[model samples]
Target: MNIKLKTIFTLLLVAVLGTTFCFGQRSNIYIADKPFVQEYSIKYNFTNERVTLNSVVSDRNGYIQVLSSHGLLRPKAGQFLFPGELVNDVQYRPTSDKGITDADIYKNQIIYIDDKAVLSNAWAGNLYSRHDLPNAKLFSAGQDFTFLIADEMELNLLKDSETLWEGSLNNEIQDIKYDSENDHFFILSAGEIYSFSPKNNKLELVLQNDKLTCIEVAGKKVLAGTSDGFFEFDAKSKKHISQIEKNLPWPEITTIKSVDGETWFGSTQGAFKLEKNDKFSYYASKRWLPSDNVIDISKGPENSVLILTDAGLAKICRKEMTLFDKAMFFEKQVRERHIRNGFNATVSGMTEGDVTSGSMETSDNDGLWTSMYLAGEVFRYVVTKSEDALQNIRESLDAMERLYTINEIPGFPSRSFERRGYKYHDKKWRRTEDPEWDWKSTTSSDEAIGHIFAFSAIAELVDDAQLKSKAILLIDTLMATTIKNDHYLVDWNGEPTTWGRWNPEYVNARPIMVGDRKINSSNYIGMLQTAYHFTGKEKYKKTAFGLMEKHGYLENLMRPMSEIGRAPETADDWSRMLSESWNHSDDEMYYCGYWGLYRYAFNDELKAKYKEAIVDHWEAERPEKEGLWNIMTAIVGDNDYDLEEAIWYLQEYPLDLVNWTVKNSHRKDIELIPENFREQTIKEVLPPDELRISRHNANRFDLDGGSDGRSEYSAGDIWLLPYWIGRYLGVIGEPVQK
Candidate 1:
């Protein structure tokens, strides 16, 4: 009876997410490849060569093998194979299953080879018999999608595992980072650098090639160290474009890391660096780094560089690199580039649904920028959690301290240098590296902002005067360099429209007494609150008052004018000019495109204005999806709708609820923004689907319009935030894992 109940509940879950209502009735789209099996204690069977797996393994060669859950095949030496007809290397059809490819072997059901195996890595489980790995801790677990894990049984046979990974000496990984932007990991293995997404149920082989010395991912490039020398590979095409063999003084390339638009590699002799143009330079020994023999490299914000050497972890930073300095970096890139492809098609087209022509950008989410922010948040969170992150905080503080003591600041007080983050490039946007803060320029301000956030987080967690003082120095420089006017901050550099609005000059330089009611806005309101806590700077408050009281900033909410405060260009245009406003003042919570911005909004006025905007927008668009004539299902989880109206909207934007719920563990009101919908009208009644998604597959032409942009973090920002918030506030997430 219990089993039957479990089965029934599972089917109900499927029904909740599977169906959509078009007019008044439900329309479920999924016609399963086969009916749901309900046999008791089913025996293992491999009759069909290909099977849809609940979980699987991924491998390097791009080909995957499988272990059938219902097959009689047993495991051997960590190598599990399909029980039935093993197809030839060339074109071959599966003996039984339809559309089964060599790559799909591991993608199919996990054939448990051994029971009670515990060779789990932090990212994936056991790695051998079952594909039970965990998602990489460092990478984001994107909402509304499911990715399987690879087990050891498959790993042992997939690639050449003879050599121990460099970071693992008793087989323990040093660092495991999954780049959700690029969709791969930076793994340290037995003296070699391995870059790959987990192959949960895949089997392919790569014979040994010892020439490889280092491997790293820089934007679209994959850098590798080889026998002859070093080379950069195309991340998409997987083609080796440039190579310099035996170029390094040292023979072995120990590690290669991507940081700030440059590729840094470590070898037995020392450390070396590479620019996007493939220019090679050395930074090893006491002169550039502590030791020539480098073991690992981790790049952090504020020109901070972490190098793991024979002498332990060594951190290097230019003393001047600060929050104030980073805006210049954004200014430089925005001045040089003009490429926008992600979601262009969707916005322009009136088709029921479709994708826009947007190229994948690198920094769409500003990982580096967010990293700086998150570092501060983490600093506070972990410190408050009882010294959990104290070691990290201490080490980070110590590193900065060294840079301060050394007086190694970027040369430019106003200018800065930074890597082109997640930005797609065209020749028109020919991004040229700024020479001023190129190599040793003193980066500041934003670095100060970062320090302030970090230090404040630390201060909140633990009273640390040294950290507080360091943050203070950063603000002092920012105030000195950034000229203030009319409750706004103008850029220190000369006039230029930029990206990310890191450029202060462009940010603060809104034409006053302007035509078209020039609405210059920013999220600096949050920063003001942040700044007031530490600096007690009344200017921060004054700036907030200027924007709210003086500019009539509330009028521009969703007006198609410079919104989001980061870009002036429409979805296609690079609006760095607008982005700068966020740095100068607050009120940016609205532009963030997530529920948390609204939910956790720090500034009360700004928060209220944003809520009005969301509600107003909801009211305005509520009718188009449908009038208040439908039943709200899992599909329509928004604030502006009653149960019936939201149901109509769900019918209008019917997504594959069953497939969606099965895939992702997250509640998807709109990516992470779903939390905001809890108190909304549609949420009061049982939604039609099992879960409601804020953002759905984005393209008209594509079969499934899941997010396509590599860098567009806003892709599901509102969706996920609402969902997470909902989970937090009893809206929705996954059911109890147990």
Candidate 2:
């Protein structure tokens, strides 16, 4: 359900009413009492010294039976889907001060040697052995059958003390596991595997390999762990099949387990999964494991994989959908809820009356926000050719074109629009002073850059003649106004807007080290190229070349970043402005402007220079893991660009879009750096939507604990843009549009 908080009821009821809101019909101004809050079904259970998983078994009914020192935990069917539900735990503390001595289960029965001789089964049997078996280290049970490996390498198969078969491998054994499929006990010694069958009272050699560590049976294949690699054999014919040693991240495999045809190998370094097709996937990041030294691997509920490390246990559930599924879902969400006619809704982050479920109402940067959405749809239509995508682009382009006309000025675009009765707490939304319509004035250069970026994409991609002409006209008007008004974005007040300073005098006045110098050069050149390419206006092309050759705009933009920021000695008015603080917003402008920079460059020489500049900017930005930057970099033909990191950014992004209160300042896991600008700490990306509401320009590492914990941010714009862009670039494949 889509929640749009059009009005605020009260602050006291925010936590009580939850993040979801019920709203009336669409209105010009929708006031929110708080931000939306999203609840996550995912959870993490951190195990400590008192709680540790030892062994795990999956029943036919899909219940995961966990054996631990604290007790045996049996999760009810479907427990993984529901949070806060308790699993059925049978209490039995292990007697060993260090760990469980022996434990195993088979055929709906179990037996173990903890402190005392203990046994359990469906028949309600209370059995205990009087003899002291202090050296017993392994146990297994099957339908009225039990086995124990004790003292030296003695193996005893017993039925009520009958001792059906007793023998010793005569060498110290490493580990043992019961292969229920063959109803036999597979034992591992220093360098070989032996299978003992109770049905025939016979011990047979399965296979021989050096430095054997562990073993597992998977259908027709027998997997053995060696000191340096993995060995596979044909289980039916006992024939050697293959050996794998090179690709393993860690060779000394301690345990091997299989689930749904995927085998998991646990080693001291971490765990690796061998898929059915024989491809390997590694899991070594601290985000996934409490400790990399894994001791055991077990089948978990809901097809999840349970890993017991030396420090704690982790349950990895494959719950996230494919990137394609999420991208399509976000596209639909943006289309239905985010797009207010053509203006993308943006809420004021500082407002207190925002609703928890809906988008924030704002009269700022609507053109910029909508332009990004428009570009996403343009890419979407290019790939999928869906009518919906085309229609969306048309609507957004119309809205953007309206920005130019809604105001009295011929080429000036309004920041945003609203109905008369609506006003924000900060008074940022002003009346066009028109009777029925209210539009914001004093739009910034960001809006203009966004308008040009989207307009260029539409003009180049959309097949509709009418839409293409309108896009070109808008570009011509915007560019002509800038060129005619002394290369400045004149505002309603007749003074240039604070951010609209592109005049060569103003841009060239700044020291080359200032970010404004390079940003203005890059943005102006990109804009002029876009206007000239779309409208075939010679003046646009001439002015662009004039700035490049006469003003050294090209060289200014190509300045080495090392000289960019050397902290201002004193906070001048310009230095104190938020835009001057590394001005991530400018980064957003530069990358978005790249479409025009390279794609519509004046010539091949200039195009190559633009690519070089973009690469330099991207090289500095790679550490941040900002998805849009990586995707856009790849789009510019950097095939060797970290495409995997692009996928990681998409996958690791949080599911919750709410700017929740997340605190990492005191966490032990984060490696805090000694810096001044932001809270730069190295840590795993928090679960989706768990972090603060971050703009594309914000640093990925900055920790944020939201103000009121109510705002639900719109992640659709950020995610959909790159996802569709990836699809268009062939880095990501397409999905069936539903």
Candidate 3:
């Protein structure tokens, strides 16, 4: 063959092999082809002190009108336009010439009821056309200016200025809704559902249940909201279609309505949308509503849902976004407010969730957090070849490098560093030789393992020689120091930090059931393997084997996850305390170290063993559906590692990372289990948006916690790390095109 043709043929053959390999490795997990809907709130709080809102409606012109006890009120836009920003400037200005009691949207126009008449803006210009009906309590408007007006005892149907029919019922009327498809009105009294045919001018009883509160009609279906739950009925048959839907975020149904072919329910506790899968997307608390007491629901502008509560109005907006799109948003969020001296940090002490009023705070896990962020950027750079990711890597790597140099201890990384005299009341902060700075001491094992995880990733994945060498040197320094000092992180004071001990004396001292024994063993061996892999140091390998064979470190790490539980009562106070419940932080440390332990094993036999241990750990962690842990387990080439659950975690995570006060302990739907060793609070975990904004180190089953919007967490380690790593591992695919 000619040289050009031979070269092309070789390239084609390589490409075909690569494609086959990729398909073979592709997980059996079904990833959604379309983008998921990300929901957020745009709140319009109650600002008018003189008026109390009763009912709300939205017109096709995108105008929202509320019926207050005094008059009709319309919303005025707020100054701030950002998503998730609280719009307190929305004033409900009076738009009616007379006082109004109730209202509904009829043919894209507002039709309302007053003490003396039923009025509408659908007739002409700005003037409302009225049909006299005294003591109107409730009303609904149908096609061609037809109206169904109801009082306590009387029901009146009117077409324009002329009355079509009048009827009386035994029970007091509660609500009225016009069904365009059936050409009739579904009426709800205190206990009965009646279908009134306007064409025949007759009212016939459909069903009777004492618990019924309100009614709605969606095409051929009739929905009745009861005191306990809601019921669905076939409109044509006028019979119940199925059992009452009691499985909801909250029962005690208050109202029901259909918007854009979807049924929405308003309850005493919250508002929720009935999804296509027969599940509910719940909206409650301050995150999605002003109050839990939802008085009404309607369709709003731009594919949003307007929920009226006692405190104000909440516009739940839906936007179509892929997981990659969400990652980009969180990327901006981190760089804008979370980067503190090149280390990913938190914004704290905010005034009522305002991001601007917060200050970046130092943390004990600064090294671990910065390392996770750096590793994420490494994955991002490798996958996308993004210059921004490369720049981020360089900046964060500089911060990680300084952690060792900032302190006199050879490889003991400082917890954090800051300007001298800036930190207060913390004795852990010590003055460095440089008069301008202070470095924190008492660094823990988590920081040590996290540093190895990131440094080894850079040393192995990054092509830049200088960056690779720097990473390897850090690994060597840390592992050398640990081995030299007898498996402990010795501080400048010549004493091992409290939680940094990995000697057999400490590891074997704890009961076998304690998680510390396994976690510490796992981390130390991983660090040794990583050190040997990157620096080609034989001592690292020799020491790792010694610990594994002589010290029983391998047995400890390879112990079944089911065996971990509360330490024996005879054990030390520390061991007992550590095993009181599952340590989610240990889960984080184990997954982070697994990158090094499994990838840089001494041989294939140990690699297989490490994969077994790693998968066992992942099995224990499956209930949390943690994205990072599951995606990290993909390194072992498992066919199924809960990839869908991991995707759920990534997608369900809220875009607003502010530490809002989220409460779920009071919820009635979730089944609470008795407190156990794993600390699984409920039978099922709530979506991330319903829980507090927490890192992977926090328990996903934690039912309730927050700083009441007093802080915001960085998304770098919590979200972006998993997503970028997932993309790099090819467990998660690229963004789907529109």
Candidate 4:
């Protein structure tokens, strides 16, 4: 049950994140496959792959020049360079200096040197030195003259041999920039902003603060990058007005730049953009960048932003598109990247895999994972009427239905299936005595939940009579077998499976405090209702109502979530279940069973009670910010759901399907909730990959990690279920076409 339920939510999440409704404009945040690194020996090549990125600027000819410690490297004979094509190999004479101190693109040429200003055309292999300012530390190009800050505590503005303006601030300057509006050369010295106006040949202190680390000018405002984020100061008033760090996702702001009027923030973690509407968007982590550390940023062609990081350089551009376009892209990638085939087994998609190897070991819950895939296709067919979706539904349903007939048992579903000679360590595969195939037994309640959930979706959504009949037969057979065994799934060994018990004696035996009491109660009636609905069998309906009236299953299932955890004393029959922490498994069972409980209710009165119970369960789950639970509650329709929050979950979901090791245990950014039964913590949910492969019921705050930083499992059912449910419920409409 643990493996199956875990895989359902896990697989659904890792592989497929479709188009998200606009947070206004539909934009894609992506990491380039090719990073502008010295390793690539392209525009920013150094001696090796690793090098410090000092600066990046675009020249008048639209050529991008990147300055690094090794040198100012560009394409050999043209503007474009491929990875591994080194500077020397591309050009006979690299033209760039052996070592670069500082550089800027000035008037269609690279103006750079350690101690002199060399105006060089990289592609044309032309170089000219116009100034020899000894001990020159840094320089920025102005309209006619060049501004240089020397290590000898001197600031000089010169054109040719003529000195336009000269002054000494008496403080060591770290960086220098030209503000065209005021004609002031802003000097970052001693963590202060000092301006030298060549027009007036005078130096004046503009702003001083211990934390002023960097500076840039946009429009009439002087932007100061500091510990508190970027400070916006009016150039005319010279008074700080506002700080733009309110929406910064990462701290340790490193550099700030205005890209065509948009505020771009570079930090030790990643880069962020503060849009005009005061909202923030994040472009961070290895998935979105070569490295989290962003050192510098510059304007690129067509409003794009160029970013320089410790590992490489990248460009981010926004285009006008729709969510549906992205959804099609996602679908294509998942089909190409995630699909895997096992020896003699049906073709199926992996929940997650190694990004490099592109292979994933089979999981124990293949049945459940395949069921989710089937259900997703079912929903897709319902919406788009796509024949391909119908075909995918058929294939996935075949894989799921095989779980029943693969073994000798008439109605029992196998946990998974494999080839005859397949080798494994956890459990020996039974031969089924069928020479061609092998199957796993001891199916749990989670398998049943997945089977019934998927079959119900297919039977309800698909129009094919044969498929509907097949689903109904399998559901009825499974339900009748459970009933025949006193509401327990007695395995081939004639013993009840660990989680498939719903007998009144077992369901009613546990005290109200035990999680299984609520779990078994809800599933018992839910399963009975499902069987009755599809089969229209009086026996199934009679048994469902009888369980409610006789065993108080409705009351048991409806216990307030607050009172559902461990009580003052423990029972011998429920010793392991006795814990202060709320049981996540119980939550999974109740919610998974909610569909059967409400959708196929015996009557209207019982349906109302089920809705009330669902509302209470959703309220208890609100703090988790779980997209699945929230979307499931929307299906119940008892309360106004958080539609926006649900959309945020889908939108913020990372595109990279690989489960990279993400460590947030020691992060101070995550808010910690006071310790409670369910172990709730974190005011905001972390990225999906950062989270453990847990069922929907697990406490969002349960802090557990594995030694291996790789993700081998995913809760795909978690995503597909809610997305399909939303589509079916009309909460999410057809995406806008291009």
Q: Which candidate number has the best TM-score?
A: 3
Per-model TM against the reference: 0.31, 0.62, 0.91, 0.81
Q: Rate the local accuracy (lDDT) of all candidates.
A: 0.33, 0.66, 0.82, 0.63
In candidate 4, residue 731 scores what lDDT? 63
Off by over 4 Å in 3: 1-33, 47-50, 75-95, 115-128, 151-153, 169-172, 205-210, 241-245
**Model 3 C-alpha lDDT versus the unseen true structure:** 0.82
How much is 428 displaced in model 4, in angstroms?
6.4
- Model 2 CA RMSD to the hidden true structure, in angstroms: 13.1
lDDT of model number 1: 0.33
Better of 1 and 4 by TM-score: 4
Candidate 4 matches the true fold with a TM-score of 0.81
- Residue 356: error of model 3 in Å? 1.8
Model 1, backbone clash pairs (residues 3+ apart or across chains), number: 143
Off by over 4 Å in 2: 1-300, 304-317, 346-356, 425-427, 567-581, 665-673, 676-693, 703-709, 734-738
Q: Write the per-residue lDDT of candidate 2 for residues 1-738, one digit (tens) a residue.
A: 122231121222222321222212222221111112211222223344576556665544445455566655544322221222224354333322323455554553444554335344334555554224556666666445565455458767655655566788857877776666667777787777987777887888887767788888877777998768889887656678999776565788888886667789998777777755454555543334556677788665565677766655556666646677667656755655566757766443433212334455754778888888788888888777889989888888888987888778879888887676665523334455468777777788899999998887777776666666677778878999999998998987788888888898888767667888898899989999988776566999999989999999999888866567633656345533432446678778988888788888888898888888988898877767677887788645635566666676677565444444554443322455666343345533433333466668666776545555345445545777877777776666544232
For 15-107, candidate 1 gives per-residue lDDT tens digits of 342121111222232111111111000011222325322212223332223323332222122111111122222322222132221111122
